[model samples]
Target: MSEVERPARGVSDLGELLATMRPELDPDAWVFATAAEPLAGAEVTVVEAEGVTSVLRKHDLPTAGDAPARMRVSPPFARITLQVHSDLEAVGLTAAVATALAAEGIPANVVAGFFHDHIFVPWPRASDALASVRALQRDAARAGDARG
Candidate 1:
């Protein structure tokens, strides 16, 4: 059996990349922070930042004003990952993705990591955002295939 090409990479063709990579949203809510290290067990975003040490825990993590981590996003945030290996400098990907979400009145916080683009939409509207993203992927695929 031939292996299935989930997300065709190296195309760099924004349209094709968006079409092939079916972005999936995680069920558990997530958050971001400039953590010196990864949260002990929580699946969170931790990056190297020059400052006092910190950790990326869920919103439930105790914090207060004057705390190194002043901001605490409650109700958490929904995380979605586009499985395409888009280059860091890739143009139009983030814009297009954000535009789609915005059109549906869904706010998206995009985080461009090494392998894929992570989107954090409001937890309440996460399902709607996922639907919008899936629709965009389907439409892009249809358009790309039709051009052939």
Candidate 2:
């Protein structure tokens, strides 16, 4: 009898895979603060400014603040953010991570920036989603080691 070979699962060398995957970023990249107290409705616009600002605009979003020096956001799923290295581009990493999360039954929106990649996921599933990302990284590392 002939033995069937199983296909490789998971990504290896997340960084390198990410380098090759070429993921794309969503156009609109921002998430309203759903965790803050009182839950003021504010359209959190990640402006390229110095500090957080309470813009009294006609919007329900409670906190309108400026993102840090190097930050990004994913749309729709507004509760999670994927803090990344400043030097990295947003598209590749964000897309790879989003695809991985989707495979795990977790939906995510990715936003790209000049520095890092951000992911917004449902608040309830944020932790699990993050774990999935860590797993991706680990698998990548393992695969990279094997290649070397």
Score every model by TM-score: 0.71, 0.48
- Could you say which candidate leads in TM-score? 1
| True-vs-predicted CA distance for residue 21, candidate 2, Å | 15
lDDT of 1 by residue, 1-148 (tens): 9997654444467887788877888877665544444334444454445522222336545455434443433456788889888877678888988999999999888877667888988888998998988988999999999997
Index of the highest-lDDT prediction: 1
Please give the lDDT score for candidate 1.
0.72
lDDT of 1 at 26: 81
Q: What are the C-alpha RMSDs, in order, of all predicted structures?
A: 6.8, 16.1
Backbone clash pairs in model 2 (N, Cα, C under 3 Å; residues 3+ apart or in different chains), count: 10
RMSD to native, candidate 2 = 16.1
| lDDT tens readout by residue for model 2, 1-148 | 9998744333333466543332223333235332312233333333434534322122344334733332222233433444434343222565668788999899875544443456666655666776787777677667777877
> Clashes in each model (backbone N, CA, C under 3 Å)?
0, 10
